[model samples]
Target: MKASLRLQDTAIRYFLEVAQIGSISEASVRLNVAPSAISRQISSLEDILGAVLFERQPRGMKLSAAGEMLAAYARKNALESARVVAEIDALNGIEKGHINIACSEGFAMDFIPRTLSNFRQQHPGIHFNLKVCAPAEVATLISRGDADIGITLSLSPTKDIKVEYRQPSPIMAVFHPTHPLAHKKTVSLSQLQPYPIALPEENTTVRQLFDICCSRLNLLFEPILESNHMASLSRFTAFGGGIHLSGEISMRHQIATEELIAVPIRDRGMDVRNIEIQTLSGRTLPNIIKVFLAYLIVKMKHEETIGF
Candidate 1:
């Protein structure tokens, strides 16, 4: 007996590439095949499956209902295939694999690197790829299967992404320990007015939360400086230059080292954010990823208990 589908078939590979790229021309460039060839392959796949996979758009292809289902199937099959190969390698006394992670800059600055360093010490053969991106882009990477894991502070819920872990991550007032507000158990938005505030861009989740809170109270503020990089902002506050707004996790190292202090903001709107660990929906992750994920959860939980 022979299997109905062959894993090495070029038609399915082209179809999946087109589905991911959303354009035959783009997929052609990536796959080093002619656009016509990719088109023919996708059309053949549609005929064989008896369903129109994509709705032809003027600019590019949009996956139809059938396309989405098939994409999901392809992703799961690819992950399973990789897992089997890794298991085989392990049986032969070889251990090696790659894990891709996409996350916001907040985590990249300290926590993620620390975690990865520790994980590598345990499994030296397991490699990693880390992508620092916007919070929303983290979800996009996960949904597209470009990343195996995503850690981000989310402003709103995103669809087609599974939340593996979640914790309340509030926008805290970050400043040098010697700053006047540092001694307070909790500080409100009104109390933050006097100091020089260095804020992230208005588009960031941290800034949005701060802006919403100020709008409700009818308070006005002009930041001394605005930046997209949270690391720079944290550094500015760490040197006692000014105050910055961020989550505790982003400045965890700074707080731990006593270089900067993170005081909770006593406002409901400012507290309305969460740190989420995300993955593609309906996908079974590789065993290596599961192990790393458990390690991440334990580390994060331990940090929470320490009360930075």
Candidate 2:
């Protein structure tokens, strides 16, 4: 019985690690076990469950339907375990816990950092683990139970993410105040086409909307610079030659400091994006996460009302 139980635990652990990392070799490295051992454990899990968990692909392993189901179960189990630990800590009168948050680069720039700083002032014992990624990966991390909270720009509803708070995050024209279009209250894509542009990569929601709008008008504008990092793009725009597109909230600090100006874009579909505060669906959250969620929502809303 002991041996069987140990095998089951090992199989589940290895399987979950593989599922999260999406590669047996990478999971082995992360788990500090041999790739062959991880492979064997996964095979044992597949045999016991009588289902193929992963699809072997040239690029990497992709989860099969059965694997996705198992992954969901494992994530719920892990969250429940954390809740138990938190409860025990609370019983011991300890005010400590870790919050894992995943968000896109835009939020990481100023809003999240400031919010975290202010939150720690009251709950200094609490710690945070923040992972910055693309908008889609933020949802993936939350759904997999790797992150306790997810804040991102979503073009549509995700499969298993629950939106605790959402606000419209329209993309705006971000540039230095001295730029030719800065004096205008709103700018059009065609009006700005004559100047050099710095744009986010094609994968981002901002670029997607811009592409769709351009496609509709048969307009063609090639950016002088393209990057995934919001900081780099902001800095490039700050140097005073070109403009970058971003949500007003993302660059609120810079705008307040008089380093940049954000004008509403006069294009349709530019306002289709939303900033979502997300978590895994149907999971009971720890008190620490609940408090922080409320705090974050209030802060975001307050900032939305205050002008630059």
Candidate 3:
């Protein structure tokens, strides 16, 4: 019924705080207790366990071998304590929970915002934390337990993350509503060769794909305006700067408002940009995560079916 009792033991809590903070005064400040009290607690813990948990240093305290083992135990205990509290919350019909998600930059603008909107509407008590990084960094977030869920351009054969759902997400040629190429129902990569283009930076994954695709088709990509950020390119196209190429999710709202139009790029090599949902492999998902994931999958399916 309480908020779990795992770390309430004063000495254990003090040691954990010191171990986490690497300084007695810092731990005291964080715990809102006296420095002398924290030092005594740490000393008492050391005496009882018969382990020199920290090595005093001029810079700060460093964890000893014994301290590392105890720190692992403390971390495990913290997780267990959280599970107990979550279980109690569930038993009382409380829907409150927190979800951490990692995703590529595009999802931050449109896909994640919409998904969070729909999810929060039903479970208003729940909270969400979002981290946007490069597509390659998404898997690392999950594997390192930094994120409960990830959505990114497909990263197949992942190291420690598992793909739960994946669907085709082809890159599209985006341009202003009144651009010459906007009148056509579908646009190909070759059609834009004559005009100035806005392309992602040379080192980015999308740019690499564009380069490889251009090489395969013997098409030259010379961009007058080059940027690493997808949002900037979308802005450039919306203002009638030049045609840009990218996945459709980032520009969904703009396209809906007729600010920008997404025309299908009919290139075989660069067409495959499957959107994937991933989680840490062999990890049990929290209930809130499962519910949100369901919401996301439903949204993704609808988008695929109706081109949302």
Compare the candidates by TM-score and give the number of the best one: 2
- Better structure of 1 and 3 per lDDT: 1
Candidate 3 lDDT over residue span 254-294, tens digit each: 98888888888777867666788998776666676788888
Top candidate when judged by lDDT against the true structure: 2
The positional error of residue 32 in candidate 1, measured at the CA in angstroms, is 0.8
Each model's lDDT comes to: 0.86, 0.90, 0.80
Query: What's the lDDT for residue 241 in model 3?
Result: 85
* Per-residue lDDT over 119-194 for candidate 1, one digit per residue giving the tens place of the 0 to 100 score: 8999999899999998889998887778999999886789888888888888889878889999899999899998
CA lDDT, candidate 3, residue 179: 84
**What's the lDDT of the predicted structure labeled candidate 3?**
0.80
Quick one: ranking by TM-score, best first?
A: 2, 1, 3
Candidate 3: which pairs clash? none
Better of 2 and 3 by lDDT: 2
lDDT of 2: 0.90
Segments in model 1 whose C-alpha atoms lie over 4 Å from true places: 1-8, 155-157
TM-score of each: 0.91, 0.93, 0.74
